[model samples]
Target: MASEAAAQMNFQTMEHPAPMPIDQRTQVLLTPGFGTQFTDHMVSIEWSDTRGWHNGVIGPRHPIQLDPAAAVLHYAQEIFEGLKAYRHPDGTAALFRPEANAKRFNDSARRMAMPELPEEMFLEAIRLLVEKDNGWIPEEEGSSLYLRPFMFASEAFLGVRPAKRYKFLVIASPAGNYFKSGAPAVSIWVSSDYTRAAPGGTGAAKCGGNYAASLVPQAEAIERGHDQVVFLDAAERKWIEELGGMNLFFVFDDGRVLTPALTGTILPGITRNSLITLLREEGLTVEEGRYSLEQWREDATTGKLVETFACGTAAVVTAVGRVSGHDGEFTIGTGGPGQLTQKMKDRLTGIQRGLVADSHGWVKKLG
Candidate 1:
């Protein structure tokens, strides 16, 4: 059954008068670097206390008009989600676990004290945008149409309470490789000074503020010549939490794997969950519990930890070849993509591209 929000709203399409030329679009698609290139159209839905969700639109991408004193600008009430629309082998597009992304978006909305968008409406919004801009879906390997769905408080007010009005939008970007360096494996810098989230905080939420707080440390990592930053627990400042925007997984030499438990401080990642399911199906024991930075260093030094990788919607599965912090630096395995890491990436990407059977029913084909 369709939710009230979905049933009450109908997306009105507004075609672009002067869309990008086909040759230019094709050139951009050939080398769409990350989020640099956008599609012709986007999806939007407005919400208010009185109107609920109405005025859904699929129109040309344009700048938004937000009041200077909007609630989002003042109180930082914003949430967003990231997923991909992959072009399958047979010239069809499919989304991987979009329902999961919708659920997580609502979870972030709840944590941020915003209105929950109905799952039906959320999925429909993405579908409308993806279908409208299907040409923007990249055909090359390691490229796809990256979808960003976000909601922000739009009510113009200067108060601490939740806003009465909101705007939800979905945008598409033709993305190639996430890491521009083209390194076989990424190097991570440990953030000793700053922590991402603590217990009873918004660490688990996919809000803009959480990411806003991480920019400084992320910049520091870049300055130190690393690809990404990893944060520890805010309370103890020892237990490994996650990266700036990804989840961590440690593979052991004894055919066991471990990831930091979801203790209300780590974002429950869809890719992380999918990888766990895949690992378990391969008859490997995957544990989720507290893993300290000290333990990571010790295990890598003693060869107990053979591989470490980060997972997220954008990067998928990237091996952590090297780790560095204020204390020192250490290499994981051979300081390159591990055998299992490559295997996992191949299997996951294979399923995503429809080359392998999606036994888990995760692929939602949109023809």
Candidate 2:
């Protein structure tokens, strides 16, 4: 016999009702880092070609069961996204431009030969999860609940084609700040031997493969006393691409800001896009063009490169103190976070944490 709600929906809840105490939660909220600790509950939903998306559930945060021959395991069919859930001054929980992440998540899904999840469903999952764990949202300054929404192929198949089954999950972690010390002028190492992306590759998408390719070169840069590594174009190796995890920005001496144009290679970061808007609002001329390392070194040495920095979802806006290469190196504008970099970081984080007015409607309230 079919039940009355069978025509409507199916639901699931946690069998183990384990939640952290207020003291424990306070301890985590006070600590600061990304991907460090998880909340009490997480949201999970299933999808398959045969049945589409279904089986939504909110349960205790725990490890996922995967088959030995899962498609994601064998073929590496996986993608993920990162954003934050902020606790506002009025005692409300909110998210910053979650819909944008939904669109980007689908963008990654299409590029990775995976099924596209509906944008509403993606946002709904975030809303559901954050609402359930509202207590986990941190109230400290520069702190938030870092929301990580990920999807992967769950089919236990040996084939090379796209998997028929998929799993989408959202987990929240309380993160204080991405930069341990603070956002200051940092150093960048120019990588000549390795490039981040190639033509007609997974460069534009936020996939694990691109990050994996950057680790070795990034290690080289870190060993050489640098905080980050910047890549040149794959073909000519002249035009700037981006950093290992952030996007580059250059401030000309003439009061003009320039970032590398999106030429189907660089990742269109959310923070990058936001900065473009924030700078223009402050009555600054920002340009998107191909910036060369040779010119960067020359300009920085000659004081034409007044300011240099990076922007990303993780760190927001960070100042670039210097750019160093094998042959030569140059310090960017007195080797500290420039005036513009500091102001921009302040404005962006201000809007995110509700310290300033959100005229752009980028924040989505959760509770």
Q: Which predicted model would earn the best lDDT?
A: 1
For residues 1-367, write the lDDT of model 2, one tens digit per residue: 1223233334477743668887977887788577778888888889889887789888888888988999988888889998988888889988888888989898889999998777877877788788888888888887888889999999998988999999999998888767665636778899999999988888888888889999998999989988889999999988899999899899988989999998878988898999999899999999999988888888988998899889988777899997888878889999998899899999999999889899999988776
Candidate closest to the true structure, highest TM-score: 1
Q: Can you list the residue pairs that collide in candidate 1?
A: none
Candidate 1 per-residue lDDT, tens place, 210-231, comes to 9999999999999999999999
Runs in model 1 deviating more than 4 A are: none
Model 1 C-alpha lDDT versus the unseen true structure? 0.94
RMSD of each: 0.8, 3.3
TM-score to native of every candidate shown: 0.99, 0.95
Residue 314, model 2: lDDT of 79
